[model samples]
Target chain A: MTLEASFGTSKIGADNIGVNCGTMLYNEVKQFRINHSIAEGKIKMENQVTLKLNYPLNEYVAQNELKLQFSEGTTLGDLFLKEGIPSDSVGFAVLNDTMLHLNYRLQNGDFIRVFPLVNGG
Target chain B: MKWYYGKLLRVNLAEKSYTVDEIPEELFTNYLGGRGLGSYLLLEHVQADIDPLSEENKVIFTNGFTTGTSMFGSSRYAVFSKSPQTGLFGEATSGGKVAPALHSTGYDAIILEGASAAPVYLEINDREVIFHSAEHLWGKETYETEDTVLREVNTPKAQAVVIGPAGENLVSFACIENNYWHSAGRSGIGAVLGSKKVKALVFYGESKTSVVNPELLQELMKEMAATGKDHAGVKAYRRLGTTQMVAAMNAAKAFPNRYWRDAYYSHWEKISGETLLENFEVKPTACPKCFISCSKKTTVKTGRHKGLTIEGPEYETIFVFGGLCLIPELDEIIYLNDLCDRLGMDTITAGNLIGLVMEAGQLGRIPVKLEYGDVEGAAQLLRDIADRRGVGQVLARGIKEAAKEWGLEDLAIHVKGMEPAGYDPRPLKGMGLAYATSSRGACHLRASFYKPELSGMIDRKTTQGKAEMLIDWENRLTIFNTGTLCQFFRDLLEWPNVERLVYAITGLEYHKDKLSEIANQIVTNTRIFNAREGATKQEDTLPPRFFKEPVNNGQDRITVEELQFMVDEYYKLRGWDDSGYPVHEEG
Candidate 1:
């Protein structure tokens, strides 16, 4: 789904503060090129993955769900950086409904869910 | 004497008289203040067998020794009474301007006794106490009552704690709202206030507390702020408030859903903190002097509930209303939250009751056709309960009594008459034990064992070592609650800091060990009080659901045999007898 459709772009624009989704897209493009070159010899093909970002965290991505292509060994941490999610903002992550570390390698057809940092009673 | 105001205000509404009594220095040394002192006073004044809604049942509002001082997260006060719902020791703490206002009134505690002949409010301005007729304010919502009280008292800066119509109508889970949003919102403390015919407490004071070591306090406050800002938990709380837990808890399969029938909510993301910030949150708010602003001011900008501004549908509210009731719409959750606040009812109990009613209807146990996901019906029921109308009358009694009356005791999800918070204990063993043994019944805050469990400080799936960990947590929280500090600062405030703060404020030397001893003493005393009220080992238990039902898609389950083992281990750790009574050491 398009970012606008998933996040309701109007509501996002009104609430978006320090987050710049446009810049994040540009950075992701740049990083993808670099990773593609680095993995050219190591891996044969790109891995398609589905990512879901839960709220507050979604503010950074401006989309609830994203389908992206990544290098075979690309870590969730790399995806977070490419998506403009500050390391400090992430509380935990789930991969295919299981808790995973940021270093977890992205697999083809894998689904990852990102949660924002929070604490309460 | 430096930190403490060294006085308590005693008001007998029946006689319409007020008196200022000097606080014994020994009381501070023994009980510290806030929850500890309040518990002591409850045992002393309130009879164990007295009906909680009777005039004989005393309600004590107390600030900690460090409360109103320059200590970080010290802006809290405790409201202790015999719980109209649980019939046990009931205490709820709230943050905002009220504790500081109470502290500035030159009293460490304010004890209200005897029912007023009519609705009345007590106004405390420094040394003076004025009893004002509250006939006009009685049935108003909490926010409106606070505004009216402040206007009538003619003190713009004064803080007021008022109850809404639910309390006046004697809804068993009624809460006392302060500063419009903050509430001592558990254990039916508001009903106790209602029983005494108290409409509001308006406090205004300019009196400043004397600090024994001002320089040390200043240094400590700075250090605390600096450390708190760098703390990970504090940062998370500031950014996402408690809403952060929605995704994480759901992922961990610990978040309660559908009245504990499920551990996961598929629509959790739609009702999470992120969603709230995106759709409704206007700004972040905090209690007085708190570095971490975990509270939110939210407003609906569009749709049917447009322009509805409320302080929060905090983590608990979201869990209860959103997850428990299957209400996926954030606007509906926010509206219901506002309704509960305006009606002056505990959202946890209110939502739990609705969930119970819905479950009962599904089982054909009740004639009502209420169903899960019926947000409008739930909101109507909240209002009805506040007004004590029809089915609402039965529900207004809370889940325990209502379920008992319906003869559906097994379906009521509560411990000691008080409903559990969001966490499903079936997945978290320590929380199960904590809920079962909590003095106030099914409370998470009394000992937030979920933190340790979820954070991997201990095994969440195992009962091994949980009993000892629970004992430690209970003692630690006893100190924190008695210190009257916000639990949000648990990571920042340590034992040494507590001791140093106490020494700096009170000029009384207290080691970490001494504080632990005091905490143990207070906990033991509370147990004794419960024992006197006929609580036994049996009462210290989770409901049948935890034992009989499995959570996490049936991946995890707690057995009755396992819970009994934990209870036995906990009682032994507490030095309680087999019957769960505290063992006294003879000199």
Candidate 2:
């Protein structure tokens, strides 16, 4: 069953943080969303769910955030593993300002921001 | 046999005499050392019902099993006594050369008992203990006291733990300071030290503990040094130190600024780690035998306080002054940190009390005209607290007393009369349990459960499995305290490394399970000590405001029911009664 979802074009992009750790990857990143292909009816939104990913995770693919798509109900843990990200790499994921667990099931058109795990400080 | 000193030095200040008691291997086998052994000694020596400020309350200094060895993060010692602040079981640990220095004195534990007739200091060189007049050093700041003591002792490479004016004044949150900045900086241990009327204890000796397996310990230390350099936690700390926590906690919407009226500070970046690096002259340094070097020896470069320097305004310090008091300037925060260090007061408690004063000013609860972001005012107030004058006199008694006298008890944020660390328990519910159930009051280091929660090892909101995970984290960290390893090494020393270090260093014939039992017993022992001090389930709770106020747009809050649920589960898991007292088990 396909759940109809309304998606918006996002202006969100990579933040230029002058974090002094010298360990972070600075990527030329931007937010990604579906290209309004639904009006052109060139895409089926049932099986494939398009979502936006952020840097650290995006550093691996070096692609637009919206270009990544997965099947419906994909968990964050599965997405991290599928992207070849180390299990301990990401600190947390935020969807619309709500912090997410790795077990959170991904929804279609969700824009998530993932951060690095910084602790012991 | 090896690595275990199996000796305790007991000093009677009243008689100005000392004696060496032989410890049994069985005691070392049961209680590892440092916090574990210190807890056991506190029970055996100090009576439960004595006034914390009385001479009947004994102060103990202990080194860990691996201390004075080649182990990384081993430069730490634990102080145990009845907390003058909480009037309950008290323990504080510090990292510096003091650990190995005290270890060199040829004793596992040094117990200071009885009050002296006049101010005095002790010089201990191996088995020799000399009593020296400290009437001149009595009023000096911690740094000058150390300089003067080392000058008088005539012992090269000697390190001394000294109490400053706040301690001399019997401020309930006074801390014992060493190396000018490193402090056993909590639990009112300094007051207990002061109550003994002894000014300082210098440790200098050539003795070294022979470990059971030097080659294996050497190999483990090598692996730690090699891997720790590239470790993410190590690198972050090496670069920015704990000051990075300001931004991270603020970003999580749990920075607890303006006396926790607001969880998020708008100008957090102004006083953050990045700002500290950009604005100050910082040189990364470390304790002896440590590679992580998480401490930043910072000096003010361009400010009113220029030329002032200190080891850190650690994360807890920043949170209290920068976050709680709303000091937007990192330089000012560093200055406050230095003030507390010199005064021999705990910055967390001092800043917290000052933050409360600012809140009362704002709330019209008190006549003081202080306000948030008042750096100069906070500095002056710190001096006042040390001298025990006016409002400082009330606050000198600690928040539990000061809050009531000012009719601000309802507004104070504390558990068991102690302030919480940077992580507000509201947003992170596991930290709620961490604070509520910690033997020490609202302590973060006990579990550092915030690490697991913030890192997404567990959902921060859920209380379902939090108790079990919190116990696991607390139990493991109890070993860190027992082993007296730095908490920063949690990433480097896993269960296997802990087992290997314990086996090689102490030869305890232990693994994770056996060591965990020792850790549990230590925790239970502390709980039993608190119980004897009249603490009940009522004390194992957060301030009312935490439960009532929902942070982050009302999205994050821990209800009384939620906290009670976790607390109940924590007590059950620790084998404590419904009243939160652990069942005592004889080793």
Candidate 3:
């Protein structure tokens, strides 16, 4: 299971500082790169999906003991639903402690964390 | 006659006479309500040139049109008069149950004129209004007066507006404390009340308000409450209250330590929201119909200050007492807030005055041994300031005057004789412009930019296009204050929805930006009043410190030249000249 992101590296707008982690929208990642290609030599899933991997799995989710898995071509919303998390309940998502939208699609081997709302003024 | 109670209650304390007069409808519409109404009426009805503390001067307490209703955050009333500090338009507002209680007593406003020979308190319950001798309440703390009035009135729900020993002694920065915690905390309004020999005003009524559209208003109320409760902005306040600001400000290196001499403190984290909640959090206080319970009730848990309990150290208090004074001890900041609250003085100014003393001591302006972060020394100074004793008498005159008397004029950190709030203007340049030209002098509530600037609502570093945005906000804020709606609404509710809400309730035809225009007219009218009273464009300038001293490490460093450029742009956007005077030519 992997999740990859695009444009989350730039702290550009209000949406960039999301409450938690993971890209909320898969389309944002798609737009971040003009062409999409999945990384090779990973767990081969289904035909309709592809995986793009970044960073080693051992270094992911540092300082927290939690198990999270992602599916290729899976939307952030779809991945959360698979984890039994409600769509309306979460305000932001993160791939690596950076904020993203739920509509973001997951690439292979990208560790992600979903977060609730941000209310700090 | 029914709508307005058909009369203004004019109390003349010097001659001990009271009069009632029918105020015109146009005047009411033009000013709207609250601070706008009070300022307009004071500027028009009272002589402008008189001394602020003179017998001829008047103090006007006004409630907005929506007050006493089930409207969310409608429980705000304003006190307007000439300030003994600025000698300009002095206006300050407070929120509690008091506004609704006063509004229920069949009056739009209470105008206190002249001066009393003896201390007195006003009691208005139902259809009756009476003046009682307040000799026993004189020199009493504000919280004690509120307690005594609420008990003696036999109404636990009665709202009491009280002044402390500071006001009784006529401290120029005196504030009026309402419901023990909420305060009309700026512009020296409490001193004005004290000068007239008034100690407190207590009121309670069983009356209900009648609006133009009851059904629509009910729906709007439900919506507004829900919105206020759920808004991220409002929720933040509810979560940490104003103390939430400490983290953000500290991160930005804008924490004005020791009167802007330093930007960081070693124990900054000890006085933050997390720390406050960990150390002292007993309960929460809320305004009328407001679910965002941002106010805190705190009690000391340990040490020499143990057992001391107070309602707050709201952002302004936390900033002035903790950040500005470089005192990172939460208990000490809480103690200072409690002292200022009970004393009926503006905590920001009180803290600023203490900062001046610290800076002066360092510079050898004062022979006494005063040092930054000295909580005990500062506590003693608070006592002296409240009683106007010894050196406290000089401090009681306010920071601007105190600095002059101490020969530390360059160290004074105020614009137009009012202390700057927590944020140093250098980091947020627009606020520098706001402080310089604010009609009521250096005030944060008049316009707060930190909410948008730091919260990613606007680009904090960009000063390119903020002039128009600031002007628009200033005008709109005037509408909210006058309409008696909470400023907290702007984050979630759009202006059109706000207009719809007001129109649905009051049946007023103000549409879209029309409310803003009406607000502009009110602001313009105020400026005109000041103009006639001899205010000049030259006076619309920041304190010398703001332009002269740049914060040592903050990212934003606005020079005097840069500030002038922004103010010039702001003047142009406001239809004013380079000198900050309103342009007379019609568009």
- Give the winner by DockQ: 1
**Which candidate ranks first by TM-score, i.e. highest?**
2
- What is the C-alpha lDDT profile of model 1 across A1-121, one tens digit per residue? 2222222222323235344547566445544543443354333344667878765566665667877666656788877776677766666666744666677888888887766543666
> Model 1: number of clashes?
2
Tens-place lDDT digits, model 3, residues B209-234: 46777788788767777766545456
TM-score each candidate. 0.89, 0.89, 0.83
Ranking by TM-score: 2, 1, 3
**Sort by lDDT, best first: what order?**
2, 1, 3
DockQ of each: 0.25, 0.23, 0.08
Q: Which tens-of-lDDT digit does each residue in A76-119 have in candidate 3? A: 66655543344544433445423345667766555554322222
Chain B of candidate 1 versus the native chain B: what TM-score? 0.97
Task: Assess chain B of each prediction and give its TM-score.
Answer: 0.97, 0.98, 0.95
Better candidate by DockQ, 1 or 3: 1
Ten-residue stretch with the least lDDT total in model 2 chain B: B228-237
Write down the lDDT of every candidate, Cα atoms only.
0.82, 0.82, 0.71
Runs of candidate 3 exceeding 4 Å displacement? A5-121, B1-6, B155-157, B206-208, B552-554, B582-587
- For model 1, what is the error of residue B14's alpha carbon versus the real structure, in angstroms, after optimal superposition? 0.9
